[model samples]
Target: MKPGRYIIPKGTYRLTDKLYLTKNTKIIMDKGARLLRDHNAGFFINGRTGDSFTGYDGNGNITIEGGTLDGNLTARYKHYNAIGLARGQNIVIRDVEIIDVRGAHAMDINGCKDVLIEGCKFKGYDINYTVDGDGASYMREAIQIANHTEAGFNSFGSFDAQVCENVTVRDCYFGASANNPAYPAGVGNHGAVADLYMKNIRIYDNIFDGMTYAGVRPYKFENTLIRNNTFINCDYGIRYSNPNGNGTYDAGKAQSGRNTVIQGNNFIRSKIRDIYIVGWVKDGITARVKNIQILDNIFEGVSNAETMYLSFCEDVLIRGNISNITSRFVMGYYSINVSVKDNLVNGITNEVVYVSDATADGSTSYVGLGYTKDYYISGNRVENCGRSAFNMSGLDGVEVHSNVIVNASTETVGTRSAIVATASTRNGHNNKVRGGLWIKSRTFLNEFTVDDYLRKEVKLIVAKYTK
Candidate 1:
């Protein structure tokens, strides 16, 4: 099988048992009509881009093993997508590199199920390399899995679309570098940045670098998992927003934004907050965000000026994270039922935790705005922390115990106490101290622990003298 190009005509069902291409080839779709009508089963394009292929309404399973899809592959003739699987099932695109796509998405899986994309690389079209105002900014994403909205009301045009369900991406890279500064004007606000949205999707062991906006955004999804991915120099690493436009907080409501987990990912030198929760923009209203768990991540040399901000959320947990040389580890407003525990916070000049008022309306007066409850702060070490180690001004029901706090070297006085409650004061027992002076209660006017220690030492000396 020598390498060559393979072209499928429009509105045709091209099925092959084993069609192989040895050299570079271009599979061109003839103009003035649709291309790749029903390539349902067993069509393979191998080798380089000596040619190109266009697919439209390509039903059934079509696999592009390895090649470069030169131009755009559309579904219904509107510069929409590079590859479209309309009403198709069990599509697999693996071990392929797609580049130079202009004004369209790299891969679009609409109304499809059991789709898998593994070991594939997608790069958007380069606007800078092209003549000014001549080329479109490569604004679309590497891969998009979504429902077809145009398929009017139960007519069943595009429904139940699974972009990458049971999908695994390993050792792959995706990038878009057009650099358009102007605000994008479109119907769904397209051409903003390179973004990927999925459901029941798993993105692991992949590297996303140099993106203008978010690297991966899984919106309005359920049972979606993102783990062990490295994001380098991205504007935002990963974002989860509300699918419903209504911004309401109801504990009695059903689990919304439920069971979403982001764990064990490394974010290096992010320009903005590594993880962002962008929900409820319309008059500060959004659907309830609950049951989110962030655990066991490493953030090194991240600027505190912008890092790890969450808003309008509830029932969230953040644990076992190491934040070094950063301004603030976590900042939240109007949140509820959140717990932060067992994280090492070091080398910061600002308050470790900052909670703000909900609004002038005082809607947060019930537990008080910024009030965190059922919080367990234990078994963590904090060194050289500035201002205060743990600052809970307006929060309540927060229990702090068994933490090591070391003050900065420039301070003439050590820290006032291990834990300081700014708003209203409550103290817990069994907090140990070492290598610093302690302040006694005004009524007692004594160091109880130090006095007990001296009494024991003096008794031992007198016993030695009598002997």
Candidate 2:
């Protein structure tokens, strides 16, 4: 209990056990300090207490400030885990108040390096749901940046899978706790070990509310930086993946570790996707997720999902965003060098930028198909589109230019197409749009349409996709 500073004075202690911090420890709690664990035992702050070190080389410069650790686990179900830290280095939890967490993680940060969680407030989360079998606690996470697993029992001493480097979660406040629900991931990492990764993760200015799953999930991470966060109703606000990475097309995998940067976030009303980047290849793998960057974000009110969903990625970048989505704002699949730039969309019920390459038939080995090549849609600014704004298909070096559509063809009765291009393979120039550009020419087994669209202004707005 002593390597230096203590302070703790100002109230209710109650903790039946645990609370073993060591090595240059510094706990300062005054503003009504609280600490209440008081029963159904286990951790309140027991990273296997002190140092008899093993893996990740134990006992770091610990520091916990301003208290309230209350894992009252709401009604019962308490398999434990409130503030468990495994291996460590310069750790510092600030302005704390971690509440009601049950069935794991309110802050389990195993194999840590320079960690710093600031202005904390993580609220209640009691969903054991009889512990989902192999999926373990299913999703659970208030702030678990782990490695050194046992499905994140986090190997307190031995398990050398160590890796949780330079983490930094800032200005926190994840919600939910009038009695459970809301923490299926606020900051994550659920198992992954292929050249052990986790490095330089930095989630900024957080506020995630109602996170039933992913407000920031980055497994096997490396140089991640989800900036300026504020997701509400998350169902996947940022679920960047790397489950052992894609070994080309998933055979003894190992590749996801590159620069990830979802910048300036604000996503609201997201119940499905508000930035979900996955990369688990198939159809003879080889994309394996590369440098991704979705910048200048600000999406609002999109429920059926899709305000950003890039899968099986390669060098990608969707820039300067500002959307008011109704559906698909940027959905690229089986990607390659993708670059949708200068965005400013509004109420698009269909394509505001939908690139594709893999809806099967890439020579048919199936899994998830695969084929997109270099794409570059530029200077976007669509408005009220009910169908096409730029809905490309399988490609080869394509480039849609200077976009600026408005009141796009209300629906598809006479197809007012603002650039549809189905079997993609060409360079579209100066796209300004009052509607006029369809192009369906495939030629693999004959599909031929080759440009046709002339239904001067109709209006319905139903939306299904593909034509």
Candidate 3:
């Protein structure tokens, strides 16, 4: 490939081997043009001319626009990575249709930067099972943003563990094809390094429908913005994880990153959760995901499902959202400094705002460790909840005030209230409630106030001085 513009005419061309693209190259395909993969090789390989370039400075300044890149349903998991790129910069891919990827990702952005993928369509993929089998595959993403860590996957450029940063994917459509279903995941990081992290990733104005997994899922990423997207009938709209490197290759490294904002998205009939954030705490090493802001989103048909779920998080804010979830609206576990305010929650099956740690994993260790505290739930209009409007348990220093609740605990059998505070240190004031308020301590014997311990320590010091 030379450093010029190559216009492909309007026809279908068969690709027998990997189409290598060098730097400063632009391949523009006309409408009705198609590059059909005929072999197991990758459709396009960026950088690395005959094993000459092999580092972070492999290639850059490449653009591909228009036409369709058809994988032709090649064999599954044979390392057929279409549009494979590694350690490249200033890459732009626009208005292309990528369909029927075999086993790997349709686009692999491994350790790349300054990349923009816009106005594209990513549909169809092959699973790892036969028709009789379960049709499930482990590696699934239309666009995978990863570091150059795994040699088997990131075999293009240098495996120097570079993070993919400054990337944007917008105005895209990810759905099913004529042959197979949609991609399991839209854009994410499947293989995460220990200390490496992706930053400044923006995904917006996209439509994700019927995905088996999350529409946008990122692991070990920071400074990410996922906004104004439409997700329909997916398992999760957005799933973020900051997993502790406990059992993986880097056992002691904790990949803890922060600062993610998910706003103005529309989630319709998501199967599991609209927004899910999960962190980890293993062997006393914690990967705490913090500073997340979820604001002004619309969620519909969230029946029998969690609208938002957060685990092992801190400094989180969920505000100004409208939802009609018939199940739990917002559930937080083993988290701290969480604030949920100014949201209109309607027709909830359980508590509209529930934060506790009594049974996160059916263990009381998290509660005893005091990892759940400083939760503020206020200024929300909650209506028609089958259970309490605000349920607080196994938490410390929780304040619920200035909230309006109507028609709560309607389907309760007995001994339930619109506001239930059990076995936790709580304070409620200035709340306009239409139903009952029940505040009690379930673990009275084990409930030791902070003042009690401070007074006991003072008495012990006096006794020792007198002795």
- With a 3 Å backbone cut-off (N, CA, C), the pairs that clash in candidate 2 are 248-285, 248-286, 249-285
Query: All candidates' TM-scores?
Result: 0.64, 0.41, 0.88
RMSD of each: 11.2, 15.4, 9.9
lDDT of 2 by residue, 1-467 (tens): 65788897989887777767767788899988887877775444535522345655676788888888777654335667777887778989899887777767788887778989999888877654655333546577788887765555543566666788989999999988776667888898766776667899999999999788788888758889989989998887887777644322224664565788988989898888888777665345453678888899899966367787876688888899898965888787667788988889888777787776655245433222335667787777777777878767666556665555666656774475667666444444333332233433342213222222312331112221221
Better of 2 and 3 by TM-score: 3
Give the C-alpha miss distance for residue 220 in model 1, angstroms: 1.6
- The total of clashing pairs for model 1 equals 13
User: Tens digits of per-residue lDDT for model 1 on 265-356?
Assistant: 88777776677764343333434566778888877645444456766677778888877766666666556666677788777555555544
Q: Higher lDDT: candidate 2 or 3?
A: 3
Scored against the true structure, residue 269 in model 1 reaches a CA lDDT of: 73
What TM-score does structure 1 among the candidates reach? 0.64
lDDT per residue (tens digit) for residues 50-100 in model 3: 343444576779999999988887343354678888888899999999988
User: What TM value does model 2 have?
Assistant: 0.41
For the record, the alpha-carbon RMSD of candidate 3 to the native fold, in angstroms, is: 9.9
lDDT winner between 1 and 2, please give it: 2
> Top model by TM-score, which number?
3
Clashes of each: 13, 3, 1
